[model samples]
Target: MTYSGAVTVGGPAEVHELADLMISKAAVGPMNNNAYLLRCRTTDEQLLIDAANEPRTLLALIGDDGIKSVVTTHRHGDHWQALAEVVEATGATTYAGRHDAEGIPVPTDVLVDDGDTIKVGRVELTVRHLVGHTPGSIALIYDDPHGHPHVFTGDCLFPGGPGRTTRPEHFESLMSGLEAKVFVLPDETWIYPGHGNDTTLGAERPHLGEWHERGW
Candidate 1:
C-alpha cells in the first residue's frame, strides 16, 4: 500500500520509505498529534520526532530496537504529553528548540537552533527554526541524496496554512519564516506536519499568499 500520511489515533501507522531512511508516522493522543519515527536504513539507528502521547503505542512502534533520540518540535503541552514517559522508557537523548526548552517539563539534553544538524545513524537532518506558533518551534529537513527533500514540520506549517498565532506580529513572523526558509525548497518536497495529513510544498505553495492575507 502507499503511504498517505493520514493516520488515526489507535490505528496503525503509515510508513514512507526513502533511499536512506524509513519514516513511520502515527497519530496519538486526544489532540490527534502526529509522531514520526525515522530509522536510518543503513545503520538501523532511529530518531523519533515528538513523543506526543500514548507511550505504549509509541514504544510498540519502536519495538525492542530503542531509538537514539527524541525531538520535541516545540514547547506545546499537547506535543510533549508523553515526553517524560517515552524518554524514561527509552533513555533516549532529548532535544528541543533552544528558546522553548525551558517550557518543556523534561530537561532537554540538547538545545537545537537553526542550521543545527541532528544525526539518526548516518543520516543528518538540518534544523530550521520557525517562530510564531512558539518562540522555538522547529522543522527538520532531510535532503535525500537520491530523492527530493522531506520536511517534518512541527506546528509551524500545515496543509492549508501556517500554525496558529496569537498576535499579528507573530503571524507575520511565521509567514516571513515560511517564505524565507520553507517555501524556498522545491515544490516536490514532502511535508509531514505535526498533525493530520501530509502535503507537499507544491500543493501549498500557491496558497502562501492567501494564507498571509487571511492572517491565520
Candidate 2:
C-alpha cells in the first residue's frame, strides 16, 4: 500500500500526531489513472478528489460515515465515473462547477462558483472556478484552520502539468484562470491533483507560460 498510489493513510492520533488519513491511487481501470482520498486529520473527515475507474477501492478507503463530500475537478469519465455508485452507497453530496454538468449528467447537489466556500467538519474549502478543460472546471482550496493550506486541483493542475483543454475556447479560458487562480497561491500549498505525484503551487507557478502555450 502506498500513500500516493494504493496505500492507505490510517492510524489514530497520538500525542504528537494528528490522524492524517489518506488513500492514494488504486487501479483506475483501462486508463490506469490515479485518484485521491484526503482525510482531515482533526475531524477524521474524508474528502474525495475524484472517482476514477474505481468503486470498491474507493469504498474501502471511504469507510463508515462515508466520504464527507466528493469533489470532481471536471467532467471527464476518468475523474468521475464512479460517482453514482459512491453516491448510492455513501450519500455524499456532489459538488462541481456548473459548466461541467454534461460530464456528470447526474444532478449536483452543490453548484459552486468562484469564491464559494464549502465547510467540511473542521475544514473549509474555497472554490476557484477554472474554465477550459471543460468549462466550470475548478480547483478546491482547503483551509486547515491550523495546519498548512491544501489544494485539490482535480484535472486543472498536475505534478508536472496542468489539465488539457480540448476546445480552443476552453484552452483560452483555462490559461486565464491558471494565471489568476492556481498560480497565485503560496508555495507550501500541497496540490492534490486527480492523478500523479502531488506538487506545490509554488513548484507549478513558474511553468505558466508552457502550460498556457499548450492550450490548457
- Number of the top TM-score candidate: 1
Pairs with backbone N, CA or C atoms under 3 Å apart (clashes), candidate 2: 1-7, 2-7, 5-25
Give all TM-scores, in the order shown.
0.99, 0.81
Give Cα-based local distance difference scores for all models.
0.95, 0.69
- In angstroms, how far off is 52's CA in candidate 1? 0.4
Tell me, what's the RMSD of every candidate?
0.6, 4.4
- lDDT per residue, candidate 2, 49-79, as tens digits? 6776568777876777578788777888777
**TM-score for predicted model 1 compared with the true structure:** 0.99
Q: Model 1 residue 119 lDDT?
A: 99
lDDT of 1: 0.95
Q: Alpha-carbon error at 35 in model 1, in Å?
A: 0.3
Tens-place lDDT per residue, model 1, 1-216, is 899998999999999988899999999979999999999999999999999999999999998999999999999999999889999989999999999999999999999999999999999999999999999999999999898999999999999999999999999999999999999999999999999999999999999889978899
Q: Looking at model 2, which ten-residue stretch has the lowest summed lDDT?
A: 9-18
Q: Candidate 2: which stretches are off by over 4 Å?
A: 1-27, 167-169, 213-216
